[model samples]
Target chain A: MMAVTVITIVLQRNLFSVVVLAGIYSFLMATVLLALDAVDVAMTEASVGAGISTVLLLGALHLCGGEEAKPLHRPWLPLGVALVIVGALVYGTFALPEFSDPLAPFRTHVIPRYLEQALAETGVPNVVTAVLASYRGYDTLGEVVVVFTAGIGVIALLRRVPRREEER
Target chain B: MKRQMVLRVVGKLFIPYMLLFALYVQFHGDFGPGGGFQAGVIAAAAIILYALIFGLPAARRLAPDPIVEAMVALGVLLFAGVGVAGIVLGGNYLDYFVLDGDPVAGQHRGIFWVEAGVGITVTGVMLKIFYMFAGRGRSLDER
Candidate 1:
């Protein structure tokens, strides 16, 4: 389902359809995450990727128009580079431990400690929340700042036009 | 403007539930499959749905640009403040253990505030982006 969406998005010339397809792709990815039992990530992907991003893209389409422009030059170099990168990543994945292996390095490491201690340490029943908001507080704080910066950037780029007219 | 009666009625009925569910996700995150990030996005999405149905100007009236902008900064400040608070309380930066006399309670308190901060910022960011894109190209008279 996900691969089909991606292929259709690539083949489609209409920017609007591409955006919609991208949303579908995100929804499929979210379903895959849910199947993997990463509910938190699935929820985020559904909301941010499928829902908000689709709206934002539509708004952008309103400004830029819905049809995609044909490329003036062929993208042979970038395509080769992308394929090589994908190949490398696929090769690297071969070295990864088998899925959900009990004796895997990850399973043997800090996760057991977190599972044992997170409830007592954070008083939060959800281990993901405890880790995100308490144990990895600094990282979450950085993420918030990044989100804030994105808002600032969008405002800076888009908000000034109306204010400039007002000044005149 | 020709407003669809069915859309108006259905949207009115649905928006409240969306907002209520967002709150549930926010407050219940500690015990569920949600957290501040998910809750904030859900809340922002509710408002965006409102904007989509009722138009951008009406949505702006409900959540003004100034307030939304303030929320973005305020959330970051709140998060940083919690971390600074840890420093002032004689623990390491962002140390939840020293937030109160009881280490466990302090951890809870710290996580709560930190999550709230994340929620606020995420909500603000999502809404701000929506406003920026929606406000462009269209004039009030056109809507």
Candidate 2:
């Protein structure tokens, strides 16, 4: 369904319709997250990745003069990369343990204890919160830094100074 | 222009609650399905609604450009500063428990504040992006 939406957007001439389709693709990906039992992530994906990000892209289209009639340059390259990646993932999935398997290597690891012990030990009820804020907090800090850098990228892009040589 | 539309009136009613609810989500994240990221997005949504209805300039007036940019930088710096303090206290980088005599209690305290920083920065950055996309002038906000 997501692939259909993306392809529809790519093929469509109307920029607004393409943005709407992109939003739909994001909504579908959020559903996939929910199906995979990552509800918190799904919630974030729905709100941030789908809702705000799509709106941002749409707003950009307004400025960029949307919808070129030209064909995509090197479309087959992307298609080739995507197929190889999908094949790799499909093969890798077969080796993975089924969900909720008690004897799986995942359950035997510290992750299970992290979820089980977070509330009793850290007083943080949400295990994701505990893991993100505690055990692997340094990485979370780095993630925040990445977000900060994105903000800087926008600022630097917006704040372009004209060249002295171009001045009359 | 008889100033009335669903977008305008509903947006007026919803924006404040959205922000308040976002704050609640940020603080209560230790116990619930939400956290700084969720809260930040919710808050940004509220402002975006305001921008969509009233206009980008009014939203920018509510939150100026430089202030927003500073928040984006300062928030991460504040969060990292906490971790750096922990590092200076002779623990691994971002080791929060080292901030107190009891590692567990210190971890909770540090995380709460750090998440707040994340929420603040994210809110500013999201709003800034919205403003940037809508453009710099103040045409659409007053209505």
Candidate 2: which stretches are off by over 4 Å? A1-7, A35-37, A72-81, A161-168, B1-4, B88-90, B136-143
Candidate 1 residues B32-120, lDDT tens each?
98988999999999999899888888999999989999999998999999999999999999998898999999999998898889999
Pairs in steric clash, model 1: none
Q: List, residue by residue over B1-143, the lDDT tens digit for candidate 2.
A: 12558778788788889889998989988887678888888888888878778866678898888888888988798888888988899987777778888877878888897888888789878887787667622222322
DockQ score of the complex predicted as candidate 2: 0.48
Give me the TM-scores of chain B across the candidates. Answer: 0.94, 0.87
Candidate 1: which docking quality band?
high
Q: What TM-score does prediction 1 earn?
A: 0.96
Query: Which candidate leads the pack in lDDT?
Result: 1
Per-residue CA lDDT of model 1 for A3-104, tens digit only, reads 788889999999989999999999999999999989999999999999999999998888888988899999999999999999999999999999888999
